[model samples]
Target: MIKIPFIVSARAGKLLGRENFSNPEGAIIELVKNSYDADAKSCLVVFDIVFKIEKDEDGIDKKILNNDLSNIYIIDNGEGMSKDVIENQWMKIGTGNKETEFISKDKRVKTGAKGIGRFALDRLGFKAEMWTVSNDNNGFNWKMDWKQFDNSDKSISEITADLSDNDINIAEFLKTNFNHIKINNLFNEVSFNTGTVLKISNLKDDWFEKDIAGVFKSLEALIPPKELNMSFEVNFQHLQKPKEFGKVETAFFNDYDYKLTAKYDAEKLSVDFVITRNEMDIDVIKKKFSELYKNTKAPYDLKTLENKVFKYSKSINELLELEVDENNNKLLKDLGSFDLTFYYLKYNVSLKEGYPFKSISQKERRNVLDKFGGVKIYRDSFRVRPYGDTDNDWLKLGARVAQSPAGAGQRIGDWRVRPEQTAGIITISRKNNPDLIDKSDRSALQENDSYEIFKNIIIKVVKEFEVDRSKILNVFFKHFKILNEKLRENEIQRRAEDLVNKIIEERKVVEEKLYGKKYNSVDLFQQKRDEEERKKYEEAFKDTFKAIDDEKIEKDNEEIVQIRGLASLGLIVSSFAHELKEIKNNFDDINDLENIYTDLVSNESKKKIEYNDGINIIKSLKLDTEKIIHWVDYSLTAVKKDKRKRGNLNFIKYFDSLSQEWKNVLKNRNIELVIKKDTKAKYLFRAFEMDMNTIFSNLISNSIDSLDMQIKPAILVKQHF
Candidate 1:
């Protein structure tokens, strides 16, 4: 057995001035909450401001002014209350109907709690009336005067309503005053039905002062409900349909989608985001935003708050989209959808709670919200603002407003609106929205856990896109092969360069030993020898050494140049392999030139030809003269020598090889490569196979290094000669 404890309060502290609304906005929100608790599918709020002439104490005729008259009506189709319920629940103060065991037929419990919600009506109008009809019992009608509650001298009887109203004129007046409440004067009606209506009158003059219509417009646009499916109108004209805040128009490289939408309201700033499925690989969105808004300081210096907001908003799709398994099947039989909306409002620091009335601590306020502010998240939408308490830092200070009510909170757990209750809320508040434009949460940008998750998702998507395992494996093999080939080429180039340098040094030593005595002797015997003989010998020696040094330098330079060229070629080959593997693991037909190069490199062929013989042979060939001409032209091009003095053979080769290996890895991962080159060139001098290989490897490795990781993983290589 259990007993309920009863508490009592003195009547002196019971009633106060009707205008204890604190603010007009809060008063309106209370009314809206009531409609929602009643399970109203749609609620409409209309503001009406009526003007009349009144006389002052001096008997001077003065017109009492009004802003608007048609805006003071709030209509809903929820379950209307009976006359008795209206008197006890609607008119009476401190009566707890929400605690009663009144459950709807659908088994859905009510959301309203505090008995003081009706008291919020005091902010709207001076005089008020309520008309309702229930179908479960005999039909009845009733109305209450707000002015009566404020009149301390008036007895309770005067404030109470009489259900007996049968006069035709009185009925007409009631009908005119309460259009939302349907009733006939001929018979009393009272029954609990499926629909309910509420009409309020005697709107406060200040109700129209804050632009009620504008507020509704903003609310409708900002928070479009999917469950209740709301519609709003000004006067008789319906409001325009709300548009999505962010939409991706262009697909970026790597199939990453980018979307951005921004709104600026004096001191309030907001940005919406959407990223492509794969684009989540990198956490660059926050970086990009920081760069964009770096010039402006964070409104409240609330780094944590800003970060939470950005992260939550950016990953909205993840919350709404269904999860899929490796087989591309939905993980859950039923999926949930979510819609998030962020609001930012700015107010004076002095208005905030816990701070001095004359001076408020902006840092403290921001810190408080960053710690705990705005609405908590649920699965589909926010629970509502101020879920835990009204002591939020930002809200207390009147700085900002954020409403996201998803997550573990009970206030927003309405199954009718959110069928799958697996959502969370993230609300952030700042001193001024404009501050966000300048200040950023550097900590959020540094965090990489979320990025790791995003990368895994991208990898999964890539795997799904590539269904043919054989093709994927082929690409892997081809990439590996190209990488190995590039590594070999790089080694050959390094060896060639070293050998060229050694050969040049040896040649220099031989030349110096051979001509050293002859040159010295000639200088000494210049007067004794024949003039023509001396001149001819000197000229010949000078020309011979110059040509030798030039050849040596050119060979060394060729080794480096060729290595770079080969690296580029290797990258192209890897890309081609990736493409071929992706398209059924079949390679494109090799061109005759490519085949010739492959055979030349693979096979040892030592065919010596004089300069004249080579020229004659090219002329004799009838096949495409252009090809031969191009080959000859390329052969004439000069090669550049290595400029760096340090010679770390292993390091150079290792770096070149690593570059090629990375390219191969990318190809294995399903990347593509393309290559373009000028006509092939012939070598005039004999060169080692190692040298050629090294040149090819270095060139290809460099090209592979330039490939972008985010793009379709493709590389393009172009060679001049």
Candidate 2:
């Protein structure tokens, strides 16, 4: 066999760094993740922007000069690398050391899997320097000019970085080099023997206040949920505006209207949903959730409802490949158990200081949602990218709601959830769900059977939350509507009072000007005239209010009339449908009439030939009559009084009847409908029969509609009963 070496171009480094990170914020986050993997208890990000201020056309000073001199410092009090490590793992491109040693010395799971995270520094700046002190107190300074990597003529192996050993004092180093005093003082306070400091200069992007704020917000999300108690801290400081940036804190969970905790059990093939109604804002709820799970570590409060447990449906379990192995142990093929905590809120923009809005202002709550309002996924106490991003709608919730908008009512499927209205975290670990792996770029989970099942289960849990929340929110909406109307009326009354006062003041001014301070019969006459004027104005004000009330009453009456009309129309339609069904039952002799015509045609030989075509036409017409009868029967069944009432129902039997009802319809379309029961047990459930019909009919209809262009279309309804 002939061996030929594959030449790696120097440009590969640039591709790995700039191409991997879409923005500077993402590149900075990668470095922070690296710090976490180093077992860092605290990481500090300082944006030391050196710029000259220039007055704009509006005479406002702006930092738009010398932005190229901006420097970013990312310092971490972690286990810094030694010389050997720098030469081997740190120097090597795409090193597998992290893959082999996935856990840190502190027993923290390594967050950075792709060894190329170091390249993030290159993405941020053309030149970079690293000052690191190892556990042995031996310090090393490494420098790299990333611009050299752009030389396409040179191979990656030919390029080299500079590394030198040095004696470093943490305090002395900051005093000598660090220009940002606040950040410098912070590092001096934290005593650490082993740590790494990255001073990146010759920046690629101009650092502005907004850009720095974005970085700060990203850092806030970088911290794992407090329930994990990871004890890691990240501080952000801007030299230009030091007060605005500080310790990265999470968005307030106490502001949530509803908290839903959902957990799936792999062994039991069951899912549990616990919903807690937070009278928080109701009482300005501010406490965090407290109970900690065995696998997923988070402490949440135990203000919970009676847990609702649902077993996996037959089809869902089949997709999961639930089975018993040869050793008599249960086995789940692709899917593992996962838990999700979701917080939902309905924003009130014009909130005033009161019971539900005391702790936080409306603006503050809106800002929080603007920053962190989407569902995010965390793996091994670290977040996965692009899943919960503002632009990333992995749940397709927006699309779902766009297709069928949610309304302010308590109806199944009517109150669809929106992406912005919720914030949540889904925690998964590599040990439990090895199949659900991230792609090399760490953008999202690999789209496989496991991922599909995972997304479906999450959406299912969210839907359950939506159903319960709709009932509560509708009442709130109605109360708000009434409150708003009362407030409007009060505003009108206040305006009326202001108008009457203004008129009285004008009359007094005119009277004072005309009647020249004469105390006598003239004063009395003026007083009498003023009293009459006051009474006339008061009467006009009352008349205006009366007119407003009359208009409101008229509108209310119109709405009542419309509702009654709709109810009467529905009764008429139901009556007609029943009468049509009765007529079809009594018209059974139509088939007998067809038989008589057939006999008449068959008796005369000459007429039989001419009537043969007519007879076939009559038969086809008879088939059309059968279709009409089927539709009428189905319509009559729908309006039955028993179906409208709620009771326990066998879902499997219901499906069987539903299938029979649609049997002829499907046959005409040449589509097959199959219902398979995995067990003999009755899947009894309490619900209105009409509700069940609505749910399944819509599902089946949508399924059939989508299959219009597919070949050999069929629907298989599988039940685990």
Candidate 3:
């Protein structure tokens, strides 16, 4: 049979370049990644745009004339390629060189694998020129006209690019052609004998001031934060907008209200998380905090640190149908470790008062969020695409907020945080998580088991941030509301007192004129004054009582809301308990059959079943199942439906039930729990049983925590009549 040869047309360049890149920003970023893979310490991006200065209300503004005089230049001090290397590797499409040698000489993970990154030049402009010098001091000039590839009849091999050896002055070239003031200083600061310079003309897109600013913002976060020991740096310069030029640093808010960090450990199947409130914000809230009602106080608890192991939590284990080892450890061995950091800002009109952080205006804060919000994923210190983009709700936070809007089942003035209110970074690496692969289009991580687990874990951590932030914000809003109400009341009382005094003086003057000296008679005047004073005292008492009553009603409403929230949680627990009972029953049936089979096999083989591997496996499974069933029973007993209802709860019976329920747990911990009766009289109270459970649960849990360090620990519940 005759072998058929595959043919590729020159037009294929369009598919790889223009069609592949969703935007000019992405195309430029791809080229920058190439520079990074070359182990470059610094990369400079210049937007050469022709513009005329125009005066506006905000002073001088650059008006971009047109794209006719726009050119883009990207320069990097990297290990420049030789002629042979350029032709064999850079010139070839879909090269596998990077795939084979995935690490650079400096031990940096190669960011480009597909090797079509060179086509990014075509995506940016119609014509491109390059100048490069290798370590041997040998220079080369390369030029390509992308318009030549538009011809459908031309074969890929026929369309040739110009590449030739030439001696080039790197510094002189920039001064002679660009004629920019910063060029001389930049070349002086960055000393390099070997590097690459790419110039693109006949621009594909107009380079306006706004466009340049957008690109600069993206470049700011293109690499990991400097604190991560990322040696590389990026700089941006717009020739027309010289004032906007600066070194790109990671864009983050230094005055964020809350910062949360979560680190996962794959070996332990656990995540350690820390949530910290900004000290300045906490201080401001504390200062503003007032007794809105009698004896009311703010939730002053600020941050939390928890090392949560993945274990018997059905909500977590059910996520992956996870397998447990003999020691009851989840076998999520494939899910690799990752670190996530998030910063949150509670932006509301109420927060305007006592805003203790940097005095960022509302407009400025919103602009910052609009520019640098959303959670982005970084791999090998480079950001992946589309995940943290302004409109890309990869975490689906917006949808979650929509499902449970403010006041759905939460405290008053508490709302779910919107996607724009947070900025975050999730760091991952190929060496750690090989399964989380990127798609060819560089859109996002491929939809796979590892990726799903990764997103779920991040969402879970973010939930912690949201919950704590809500609590603090709720307090702030309530205090603000109370302050406003107090001010209004004070103003009304002042006006009322003024009006009453005016009317009383006017009546006294009229009475003096009508009745003469009789009106001034001691007995008659004294009786009238005494009556007026008595009436005023009664009115004052009524107003004061009304204010107190209003405060009491408000306090009661808040308590009712908290109780309802607990009831909501109890509802969830009850539902899970039902499902757990079903699961336990099914497992018990399986265990019984396994036991019977083990007995039969032992009899048939004329040996004990304990020596057989199959019997041992069954026995281990049964033990785990029994443990799970016990956990289910404990939960079901703690969250009985009747506990969530309001009624006359007998403290004696309640304490007795709690002692019985906790007897096994306390026994296992080598601790004793006792309920002491102080009197023979019945002790009862009107309350939601769940509220009592919550109060006692907190007390008991705290006692257990402290008991861990005690040699002998006991919990006593005293019942008084």
Candidate 4:
């Protein structure tokens, strides 16, 4: 069978120009990218929607232009194209010019490698006027009506545009409708003589000030911050009055609360993360912390670490070794050096309780959150679209917040910055990371093996940072727990005192009735009655005294229970605070592994490692969580009221179960724990498990403490019949 050849029709332009960009901003950005590819140092966008006011017949103010035009103009000072270049390069659909010449004469990497930037004009409007003068003194002036390309009746080759070859007088061209256009202001620079100018009309979209502002912001983030060789400025004219046109103000990654610089070295196999808090905010945070500490009476001063920037470094293999198998570990050796710089947004006003800046309500706080929010990804200095969008949560931050353990400080819920709560970007360079390339659209990174690897690494590093923050906060807030305990003690004692007073008052009333002299009777009957009343009074006195004693005993018991609870809680909190101090160890290990992975992968050998398996992390996290739970359980048990109940226990079995608990630790310590019966004690013993466990625990702790420094630390549990 013979195959019929097919040719692309002129209608294909409809797809390229109109459908290539997802939005108007995207379309406009494509033009900016074109300018960048041309090695332009500046690109300006002017909305030709000039505003005017005049008097109406009734002498009232009126806005001019009932048509409400929303035209747009893009001008750039770059190496413009000659007539031949325009005809063969710019005019041709799907030309390979940009790909063939990936680097411009100025050495700027070509962002518009697809060579279809002209389609962006189609996305803008139906009609357009273009003027360009090449550096070689040749010029091309053209006009295109994109609607002609949509005619199905015509063949693909039939689509045409008005064109000419001449010295482009940009002023004469733009002055047709925009007579007020400032020629000197736009084309005064000698370098700008040979550049491109696009005057688009028949406005497609009804753009508002907000829309223009959005476009302005996107342009600010378009260029790479690290590409010092490629310096470009973007200006926009939105309001037309006495003329309000200016450069777009961009917020760099450094314009954040926390600036984190993380680097993984290939040869050194080491990871270094430097955390710098915003210098301006140090005093505010430190004051808040100091006040918090004063309230709870925290022991150590954080001032030393507060103002100082922290740098922690470790080997990568140490972090990832226990996480992956030895054979698969080789895969990590191929990774290269990568730098991840992260910025974080702090609340405009600290929402912390007891802070001076508490004027904002919850709803207002959300408004602030919207203003300074979104954690985004930057690959080679350019943003990855949809990653940090209002709808996007690449980190699933919302899910994490929801799943965070209950009873966490409200800060953990509301104040903790989610991806949306953060306003920052991670900068990665394409030169160092060749494997992680941007997609043709340049909107995001290609979801290849490298992309997945990068994403996981980022998440792990961020999670570690998050944990570090929590650990720090836990230390600061420990005092609050102490303050709460004190308040609880005062309350519990007040209740117990009232209960004891009530018992005493109740007994006093019975004694008063027994001794009352209101009763009168005949001599004999009265004497007998008095005798009986004396006996009754005696019994009543005995019972009443006993009741008072019991009430006092109960009051004292309650006080003891309260004290025990507070002490237990203090122990747990103290241990946790200490652990938080050492929390760096856990994450330092991970960092160590990360460095090794980087060194191995980035080494000359180009090794490969499988470090994406998160199971090890899960296992480690689970073990830590279980330990915390056990601490809490012990605290809760200390305060429980019904723990003195008797239970029959098989001492042998109990010892066996307890021995199993220490088996792993014993093995790790190179010691064996042996449990034996000193005698044939077969009979069951009635005792409180609480008391038994307490006694056994003390003995075990003592033995372990003494054996800790020994060559082999062993524990022996025996039942002495």
Candidate 5:
């Protein structure tokens, strides 16, 4: 954790010498608290003008009028302060009256804490004087001259002393116990009983530059009475109250009241309207509603019921009978219910006393009238405008509804009612403006365009609400749809597995028919006889060759050698015949073996076996076949007694043909083959071409078998010189 150091000293001077106010209105508020503390029912502030004339050096007079300064005096008939309180509480700069036991009866209602309100006079002027009489009939008079404490050397001691006879008497009464004062001077006199008079002179004239009306209007709105019993007065006069303007009439309507009401679930919004009998003439109601609901076409046969009033008392009944006809056919049908009511209001006009009628100006009256401009909505005849006109954002109707349970008052039409259900006593005036009426009519001439904006907003909100509900339903349906699709897919997968099993069974039978049996006795016997004959032929050939080369002592021994060679040739021929017979038998055996292996490999049961098992079988079969081929080649070579030779071969042609044949073999196995030769070279004599061919053939065959087991097989054959 990071520890934050608290710098007590750094913040100590933050509020010191600060004005404790941002505007003149704040200072005035402090003064009001002082009056309340004094227990005064009413306090009046007076601004008095005192002029001083100065003469130029040329002896011509010049008027030196200071608008920045004014003499402010506050008079109240309340329990006054005594000499001790004036010195210790009133005149003291930092004395805390709130902490004193005798100063206030209610601790919660006290506004003063530092008792520094007296310093406010210091900002306006250079001096202050307090005069008062105690409520106990004890006279006390006092004067505090801040100039005496001021560092400036300016003084009016000479002027004040010349009037000492009058000033002294008033000062004695304020500073000590005295019944009355006999001062005859303008500045020295006791004016009231058990009250305090505070005079602040040499006020900064800039304080008078503010718009007093504007400030007062805002204060009135912010501080509305909760019980609707308190009335506020500004500049010693009451504010002009709101008044109803006029009743708009249409054609001759029914003598019964009509109501309209609606409720929305998503927004939790509810709206109700109460209309009185003849409150709206037929023509006016239709015209206004047409503008409000322009998107809705006129109902057919609506003229017959144009001046009629709906009679249903309950919302449910009204919804059942509700219908709109257009073009001689019913165009609108309702599915829900609504409630509404109506009434007429009388209007009276009043204005501020000194305000001019024609030249009053918008700035002077705008703040006062704007507070009551909006239509007041009510739930139970109590005002619900939060903070009155101070809150301009009229949205949050749902929020107000939520708060209604907390016992908040509702606004009844244009009146603000109390929680006790008492009506507000503030009387307002309503003045009709014929010019405004004419303007409204002229602007409404464009019937379609005039209502287009409002119509769009209503339609947008309604559609948005519907769309939200539809989205919820769509999500619900989508879940079930996905579940159904999953079920269908599972069924398909199961069928695919069954079909695959059936295919394997059928393939096994077909493979058995194509290939023969394995481990036949006939094949083993023939292979063993071939191997024995090959060995015998090799032994006989060697013996004959040894006799012919016993002693090539003389060149003439050729005849004997020839005889030996011929005898050897005869034995070789006999051996060759036997070998040929054996070769034929071995060939038959090999054919049987190939058939058995092919049958086993191509069987459906084998196809279903794992890849590793199939590869092991192929490897074993290849080893056995290679052994058999080697034995046959050895037997043939011994009988023929042929020597190994080498010959040049076109490697390109060989590889090309080999690749073509390999491709054809791979096609049967569903494998692809590619063979490449680079810089083919002729070989020196070493191994015979036939032996090489046999070796390569076995290797290629084994490679092909290995590739056949793969899903997509590819074989690459390459030869380098």
Candidate 6:
């Protein structure tokens, strides 16, 4: 065999850089991730905006003009490259030292397995200057103009980047703590023992305020979640006019009305996704609830309702957990169980001054929330690009909600909560999961079953969360109603005061009568009139409050009955998945499933199973189909009440109905749910049927969660007379 030297094409950089990075922001993210893999403690992205002001042909006024010259500098205090490494690893295309060194000095798993991050610098601009200092050497510098890529005659091997060992300038710079300020200074004099810097000039495109803002937001997403050991600070600045850009402080994810957390099992299954109630908000809610239920008597048990206030436990500020079903977790086995935390500002983002919020304006804070809001995916402490885009609804939340007719009605209510309303990050570890493969180009995750299942799980969980939230937010609506009632009371009081004044004027006129007996009679009549006015005003105030309460109850009832369709959809999908799993399991036992079908159609010699088996298979298929239909009917029945009716409900009958609904789920999970009343009393209690459903469902859900953690689990739902 004759061996020949391999020749690489010159257009490789164009293919790797231009085609690899979906956008400039995508390229920037790769470089930032490179910094992270190097164990960076802090990364600074300096957007050195250049400007020139000159008077136009008219000499009176100065106008700002784009010099068409702006530089982007990314400096990181990470492990820097040495001279030899620059030639062998840094300059090499589609290859890097990260593969051999799979972990950092901090034991962080390396994410640059494909080694395409070198393309990031190329993606940023046509010209680049790299200055790096490592403990192995004093300094190493490299400069390259990518215009060589335009030459059709040259191969990638023919296109050699010029690199040099700069012991004079860079060594002195490193010796001076990386602080050698140039006369035309463009970057900060960062003091670090070892670091790397990339100055990208002659940018591929113009850098505007929006692009800078987008870059800032993207950089924020690049920083790994605080829960990771790989936490780093990212800060951006304007080199020309820093003050005009304002003080850009590094911020952590904080401002939120609701925080949701999903805890997964060892199998990467989402065991529970908790939509938590803020304890501070809960405390205020408790006070308001106390006022509402102060003396509320028969037909409504305020004590029981108060106990379940906003799904909170009796403890101070503890999170209320939303228990997930086992069927929802089957696909997570190989996906690697990870934590996904989401923060929802909801409509409450408008609230005034609090910690973190007090320092920032409402506009700036809103901008931050809107910009950063999306479910970003992270693998081995590095973010996957394009998944959290404003235009990309990876979770398909809006589509799913809009499709469901149950979601506040398409005619009057706007129930669409877009992906931007929520900001979240999912932490997935590569060490634990070998199946999660970052694509060759390192642009996105592999489009496999694991990814599809992962996406499905999140949307389903979120849909449930939205439904639960809609119910909980009714508390705020009720609070608003109370405020409106207060306003009405004020108006009624004003009218009563005006009437009282008129009566007093008449009394004054009557008392001015000449005769003493006549004056006394007029005074008595005036007093009687005053008492009637007082009585009338009290009755009017009472009636107005009663009307307000009636309105509140009616609205609450409407919300519960017209329940969000997403919740039902999520459950339907969950049940459907379960049925499919069962069908597959059934088929798995039949080794001759394919042969059985063939045998039933023809007079074949020998098939593995008899023709009768085909009939059984068909019957099983029909049964599962009916099971799916049963659940669909059940969901509709649960929410299809024509009108809100208030009356006594028999405890035994209600529990029986609830148990029947959950029997299959309980049985499938090998869980024993025993529903026995404390007494033999056949007592009936006053409550809406919908209220009972909420209470029982939550109880069942919590019990299921506890049972999942046990080998043999049981729950007792005992009601007292």
Q: State every prediction's TM-score relative to the real structure.
A: 0.32, 0.58, 0.60, 0.58, 0.29, 0.55
| Candidate 5, residue 294: lDDT | 34
Output the number of the TM-score-best candidate: 3
Clash pairs of candidate 3?
none
Candidate order, TM-score descending = 3, 4, 2, 6, 1, 5
Task: Report, for all candidates in order, the number of backbone clashes.
Answer: 65, 9, 0, 22, 34, 3
Best by lDDT: 2
lDDT of 5 by residue, 1-721 (tens): 8999643331222123134543444455456456556665444444443445679999888655354444555545456776667656664446765645424442223435566676555544545555566655555544444444332333222112001111223233433421221211212432345666566675654332233444344334323233222222222211111121111111111221222222311112222222112222346435433333333322212242363332212221122233333421111111111111211121211243211112223442333234432222221111222212322222222222223321111121212111111111111111111111111211111223312322222223222222322332233234445665576456544554455446544655666667743333468885686457545554454454444544444445577566556545434443355455565466455557656766666456566656447566656766555555454554454333232345555566655645654543456467777765554465234444555556666887787666647587666767665
Q: Candidate 2, which ten residues in sequence have the lowest lDDT sum?
A: 289-298
Per-residue error (Å), model 5, residue 113: 3.3
On residues 1-721, what C-alpha lDDT tens digit does candidate 6 reach at each position?
9999976678865686677777788888778777777877767676776656777788766535253667787777787888777888777776746767788897888877776677787888888988888876577778988888878678887887778776534333533532323311323444456788888888876666677777777766666756555566665666554644432233246666557777555453324655554423434545555565465552123454334322221110112132455643444566666667777654333353221111234575568666666788877876777677665567766555545444322222334455556777787877766676777666678878777766765665565556555544444456555777787778766765666667666765776764443434457886797678767766665676667768999998678655645445543554355355565455443446555565657666334366657667766765565565445545645643321356888888878878887776676677877888745677687778877787778988987876655576888888865
Model 1, 1-721: lDDT tens per residue?
Answer: 9999643322221243233345555566557656555655444454445555679999998666454342354444455566567667766665676657434433434434446667666566654455444444334444545665555665544556445422122234434654432222111232123333344565655433335444453333223233323231111111121121111111011111111112212211112332112211123334432333344343212252244323213232242253435322221111112222222211233232211112334564344333333433221121333322322221111110112111111222210111111111332212221121111211121223332332233322222212222221232234445666676556545554555556545755786898874333346565455445545554555455556756998998788667656544433333244243343311122234344544554223324345346445544442334333333322221111221223323333333343444444445445654544333433233343345445755665575577665667555544332
lDDT of each: 0.38, 0.73, 0.73, 0.63, 0.39, 0.63
In model 1, which runs have C-alpha deviations exceeding 4 angstroms? 1-20, 50-64, 67-71, 100-103, 107-109, 153-159, 165-197, 217-224, 227-383, 386-721
Q: lDDT for model 6, on a 0 to 1 scale?
A: 0.63
Give the clashing pairs for model 2.
280-284, 280-285, 281-285, 289-300, 289-301, 290-299, 290-300, 290-301, 291-300
The TM-score measured for candidate 1 stands at: 0.32
As a whole number from 0 to 100, the lDDT of residue 353 in candidate 1 is 20
Where is model 5 poorest over a 10-residue stretch in terms of lDDT? 427-436
What would the per-residue lDDT of candidate 3 be over residues 650-682, giving only the tens digit for each residue? Answer: 888888877866766676677899788745667
Local lDDT at 689 for model 1: 32
